[model samples]
Target: MNECERCVTLTTELQKDFIKKECYDKLFKQYTNLEKHFISLEVDNQLEQESFQRNNSFLQQSIPSFDQLFEINELKAQSQVKDTVIMKLKERIKSLSENLKEEKIKKELDEIETINIELDHRVTKLVTKNEHLKQIYKQLYDSIKSSCIRSKEQCDNLIKQVNIKSAKNSDLNASLQEKALVITALKDTLRKLKGKSEVDEAVTLHPIDPELLKIDVAPLAP
Candidate 1:
């Protein structure tokens, strides 16, 4: 994957880990508190039982020593009061446990909700970044495509220019050939004229003027 995709993947993994950890921590803390409360309740029950047993033992020990019937009735009354106090303590403990459970549940839900909100925010950011990256990639691709088209057009233009130059060269070569043929023909005509002139000179006219010829012949005779 590209850099942007890699980064987004890593970030998503990290967010998942963070959410898991937060949930674990919240659950662990709630469980620990619950355990502690249960332990406390157990200890309270044990202490209440021990106190009841001790009171019973004391009442038993003192019963025979007190012969007065009124004293026995008062001792009975005190035992009833102790039983009532224990019952009230148990009820209070039960109420407190229920409240603690409710509070713990509420807190856990709140934590979950907060985590969800954070996750949503992170997702939004990742989505925005992904879109932005996509745009950038598209732009780059378009630019590259345009550049390729331009390059191809330039190459085609160059080829056209070369073809035009070749055509011009061909025409110039043809014209040069025609000019050379013409020059050759002119040279041949000039050579023929010179040959005719030489022939004419050899045919020198037997003197058109006979006097001119006789002067030359007599001079030689004299």
Candidate 2:
């Protein structure tokens, strides 16, 4: 029994030591987890402070002072208005650009119209010149035709005159030839008659006085 008591006391002491060691281990784990949680919270707080300081520095740079704070609020309202104004300005610029483009297009169209008018005027002038030229050409053609007709008539008249003159000349030549033949025949007949007359005169004078006959015969022979 005394050994059993001693064994029981030893087991109780070992159990208590094991319970203390377990409690120590549980406390150490809790402390380590708590330390880590504290470090994370501290780091989070530092990050938040740094973010706040950065925001405060930005505000200070952007806004000048206490009165500037109110000015900033007013400016914020003005900024909203400015946004509307900027949008309106953009719209106005767009409208102005469109107007300019339209005006330019209209001007170009007017220029084209003017050019067309000038071209039309030129065409009209050319047409008038062409008409004048046509009239001149017609006059020239008519004059040439009349001159040709006159020249042809003159040529016909000249031809007729030449034919008549040729006919007259032929008739005159025929008459001259007939007259020449007649003259030649008359000359021959007169010569024959003269010879016969001379023979008869010699026969008739033969019975006359010989001296008278001799004187007449000598004159006739000469």
Candidate 3:
């Protein structure tokens, strides 16, 4: 009985040691897999951290600083102000140009009116002179037609004088015709000027011929 008991005890001790060894082996294997998984996760975390740092550095380099952004905004505001000022100046210049043009037109009209008045005065003088010449020519013609001849010598002398007087009268008639034409042209110009309110420099009257002003008013001898 004692020997049997000793063998039973020894078998129990051996079985317990084998079970502890099997459990220890299984636990060690599980620990090694968990450690490997933890090491892989750590490496992945380090790589992610490095990628985050690079991205942050690139963003910092690409984005503008606060002071530079402020300067850009200031430049945009200044450009808008300059544009507004230029627009106002352009409007002001247009207004001034219109005013100046109006003034110039008024000045030209005044000058034209002054010239018209002077022309009227000159026309009156010319008309008076023409009427006086017509009267002289009529009187000379009547005197020559009513005169009676006394002798051959006196008739010949009278005929010669008449011819000379007739030639002079024809010249005077031509001059009067020229004066009439000038008066007609002046009247036409006055009509045109009256109709039109605006005119350029070409609207001014040309100078009259000086030769047309001379009148041969000398009385004819009978």
Q: Give the candidate number with the greatest TM-score.
A: 2
Name the better of 1 and 2 by TM-score. 2
lDDT of 1 by residue, 1-222 (tens): 599998997898789668867866775666566566656656665666666567667767775454544555665566566566556656665666686678667867986998799799989999999999999999999999999999989888877777766666666666666666666566557558777566457544332332222211111110
Q: Write the per-residue lDDT of candidate 2 for residues 1-222, one digit (tens) a residue.
A: 399987997898689668756865765665556555555555555565565566567787785578756755665555455455555655655565566567557756876897699789979999999999999999999999999999989888877777766666666666666666666566556558787666556443222222232211111110
TM-score of each: 0.55, 0.56, 0.33
For model 2, the local distance difference test gives 0.64
Cα RMSD (Å) per model? 19.0, 44.1, 53.4
Candidate that would win on lDDT: 1
Tell me the spans in candidate 2 whose CA falls farther than 4 Å from its real position: 1-72, 195-222
Q: How do the candidates rank by lDDT, highest first?
A: 1, 3, 2
Off by over 4 Å in 1: 1-67, 192-222
The lDDT of model 1 is 0.66
* Residue-level lDDT tens digits of model 3 in 138-166: 99987776664335568778777877887
